[model samples]
Target: MAEGGEDPQRLKKIAAAAYDYDNDSRWTDYWSNILIPPHMASHAEVVEHYKRKFYQRYMDPDLVVEPMSSTSSSQSARPSASTTNANEQQARSRSSGSVPRTAGPSATTGAANPSSVRWDQQTIQFSVNAWVFVIAVLAVLPLVPKNLSNRAYRLSFMGTACSSLYSLYALYGRPRAWNMQGMQVYFQSIVGAKDFIYFIYCLTFVTSNLCLKFALIPILCRALEQVAKFLRRNFTRSTIYRKYLEDPCVWVESNTTTLNILSSQAEIAIGFLLIISLLSWQRNFIQTFMYWQLLKLMYQAPVTAGYHQSNWSKIGRTVNPMIQRYAPFLNTPVTAVQRWWFR
Candidate 1:
């Protein structure tokens, strides 16, 4: 009747009655708060216990007198229900040292976790983003000497490319089908994904000869956003994060749109900078061509197209008038590029 002191059948019914999984807001609330740590969410018994409590509060106050009182309850020998509040029971269990706990390494004691840090993809991504931010900052800081700054910039690109690749792999595993049609579908899906675009964006500059400081803006903004998200999710209880990092994290989340727009602007400006470099001896034609292709993909990809299309329109509006007025000869090529862009 009960596996690990919780009745599977009863919990399943309770969860079904309590939750409208199709309701976006309700499901989000249940998953984020009721679920607590993610590991417990997978267990039907734990989920049902919470759902029963949720049902009692909202749907029917007296539908089930004691939800946990089942055949397995007798097997586990838990005492009769003294409270309907699941959270209160958990709190009491913790205080009385009846509840078991599992955690990764302690920040202070350096204790080993049964499931070590390597198993947590979130933590790995967080560390990678944090490093990317630090490296990007070092590259941007005026105090850093030119040689070291250039090296740091290249390292930042390398780190971002690695992080993006890992994220793609973790999100979408390798394709099962390897044939022509199957591979075509898989490639299209990957190309449409936001992570794949970011990977390519970082790869474009990995071996570039130019050290344009403006190029790091997008990498820094993206790293800050990801690092802030990880901190908010995992370090909400930490005193250090609460005192110092919380406000910045909150601000970053609140202004994500602003950050994205800034990154888009920088990217567009960098394209012009590359064109200017073409007039000098430091131009890499291959890098410029590849970067332009990447930008074209960004403009077409659903996830990034909104921001990029708007930026490109603004640039066209401003540049088209100037070209038509003083550079009439460039009008034909500009029209050709516009046609290609729309196509």
Candidate 2:
């Protein structure tokens, strides 16, 4: 290996691993688990520090790296000549499509080419989920006028369904082959995927005649979780974020399990609500049947099975004895539902 110049062999290996974006190898999985704190990771200097090191190591061996302190911003009014030259070189490389670009300075620069400014699917998902969370909150607030609240509620689910579908496609592409076996496998994979389930769950109520506000609980929690992640990763440096949003974001990030549990509880309760709704004038038999099937998927899916199963077990313990003592005649029907649930 060369000590003072780019080594093609080493560069080739690194580029292969880095650019193998579609497949997750052990190397990728290992780095994915080692997370940086969002507050620190969001800073421009921190990102530049790593970028400078990467360039020095592989892109330009002679690149002079600057050591920036927390107070470095106050000490400089203009970049040094070396830094200016490096930025120009980077811009040229980007324009020539010779370098990989991220969603950073180059993405916003006026001279950046189309490829340099293209946003990744995760960024698109984040943007969509952020709006979903905002609109979901507005939909629930009583102070909002009824017409506005209705519009907000409808829009929130639409946004959530769109984001969920896009995420599903990003994670797993369309069926590669179109034969009967290939189509069966593709549809099975989609059914078992967590994101697809979410898509279906949100879409179920999108055009329904019944306005079941409880259905919003899962969408609200899921949107809040994703939006909090994006905000923490992108907005830690903003004055408004530091003053008003930091603590809440921190809390949401830390209490993800709590949020998931709350969502699961709301979802289980919603099944009972649907059953009760069947007796009311607002009944939609198709919606009730569809939601229960979705619930069954939530119970069976590996990602959500634990939360939903725990809630289901607790409900059984509470309700079984009540049926035995107070309403033994209802015992047969409850047993029938239990059989269907397990099947």
Candidate 3:
């Protein structure tokens, strides 16, 4: 073969060798040692290298050498070329319209999933229980005696009063955090603001129901106890109808026992509400404090020195004043009578 004829073969061999060398070195040091630095060195140099490399590898050399008649080739290759081009176009269109696939259900079943469901169920059950408590308290109200001692009345009232206060606290204790002027701010500076607020709401709802339940019931129960005490006093004094009211032991015993049970129920309801409220408040305070700490960290940290503090000062300043105005409502008195009425 002529020297000129062997030129293309020799050039192809040289290109293949260079490609192999670059490809092998690519997995190790070639990218960091050569390509990356060149690209970072100068935009113009990078662009020139990219263009040269792209053309050398991708451009058809045969097109340059054999610039012949379009008519002759078109006649022979028309059908096959058209079919290939159509297939390529269809593949590209299909790929362009294809939607992406995701991972399995496990991806969505994190801590929040079951917790959210449980909360929902609890809320529903509690709502039903609250209504039942209210009905029970009401049913026992008219049976209480008016002449009962102050201590018995007070005990009954304490339960309902606490529930009312707890309900009120839950209703308005914590405001939702507002995201304003690109800053996230809590209404209350305490921890777990959201959870506390939710707990308070639930507790308040339950307590309110309890108050409605016991308000009349306890008063009536006290009255019954007073009647039994009066009957027992007369039974000891009289001799004629002594046998009729003589079972003072049974009447007195049952009345006192029933009163004790009702009073205990009231106490339990109040104590439970108070405990939940405290827990909610504690959780909210911790979460709020933590969020504030995080905000402070973001602001004070050296890494964030250049970060801008947005115009949230105006809104922040109003928060304290708002709390002050609502303080009276928040601190409203909870009387023993009111509490007993609820229980």
Candidate 4:
């Protein structure tokens, strides 16, 4: 120790010498040839001594040490040398290819760094416009009317067509050198939200189609039947009615019973459509809740499946009985209106 209980200069010299020796030996065979090789044979003995000392200090059982045989060590060097040569040859072969060199953090420092150019305002604006168009199309598709009120529905469909065309153009016309990561980032920036939005849109679209086909069509059919009945009773005279009544097949075909059967079938179709829509709504609600539950579980810990299973079991028991009771009605002839009229 020097003045103030410090040996500053001495410590600095020792550190510098150690650092220099490490760097030199790492690049050369200095330590391996002069120091390590001589002590390599006694490595197990040194390790055993340290292990025994550690165990004694801790009052633990002594660790067993197994020494490597000299013959094994000598034989290992031959394979190691052969592997090194093979690796060097492989490296040379790889270097002959046209793969681009990547700059690491250290390589990018100082004069090795390259300049980056920012995108122009026009390019940024175009990208923003493209993304806006994609989002608008996906969001509006489900809301478009089946019964066209104006030119808006047609316009919306055209917009979707145009956007799809643009997407195809962008996919095929882009530069081939663009890497997958860059393309993915580009797509995420532009229309990644559409993936989720489109799912909802498709559900709504299918539901709307079903409403048009089943509910609206059935109601329209019922209205047409009523109109036909009114026109037949009012416009036709007694003579025409008597002539039609003489043909029993014609009377049976146009009778109230036949109309009631048609209406009943229509009602069934509507019922089926409503049931499907109800199931879809329920699934959406359950999935939304499940997704939130999953997020909570991720942040905290796992939740038990018992609650979900119990609720579903209760629902199944309730629905199953109703379904079984109604199973007979599904095939039973709808005769209420006929029986009432006949009575």
User: Compared with the true structure, what per-residue lDDT tens digits does model 3 show for residues 1-343?
Assistant: 1134556545643454354333332212212322333223354444334333322322312112221234433354544533432343343223223322332355354325534643554344344334434444444456655333222334344433344333333323322323562123222222223223223323432333222333344334443444454445345767753767567445554556545455434433433344454465333443333333433433333322123122124433654466557764533342442343234
lDDT of 4 at 169: 32
Clashes of 2: 0
TM-score for candidate 4:
0.20
Worst 10 residues of 4 by lDDT: 56-65
- Which candidate, 1 or 3, would have the higher lDDT against the true structure? 1
**Tens-digit per-residue lDDT, 1-343, candidate 1:** 2346676556755655656644533334434543233443465765666666545433333235354435433332333222223444344233223443432254233223312533486788899999999999999999999989989999999999999888766544455367888667556657867778878888888877788889899999999999997888779999999999999998997788889999888888888889889989998898888887778888888778899999988988998899989999998888898788678
* List of clashing residue pairs for candidate 1: none
What overall lDDT, based on C-alpha atoms, would model 2 receive against the true structure? Answer: 0.71
lDDT per residue (tens digit) for residues 159-229 in model 2:
98899888765544455467898668667756766678888887888888677777889999999888787
lDDT of 1 at 129: 95
In order, what lDDT does every prediction score? 0.72, 0.71, 0.37, 0.36
How many steric clashes between backbone atoms does each model show? 0, 0, 30, 0
Which candidate, 2 or 4, would have the higher lDDT against the true structure?
Answer: 2
Ranking by lDDT: 1, 2, 3, 4
Off by over 4 Å in 2: 1-119
C-alpha RMSD values across all candidates: 13.2, 13.6, 32.9, 31.8
Q: lDDT (0-100) at residue 14 of candidate 4?
A: 41
Q: Name the lDDT of candidate 3.
A: 0.37
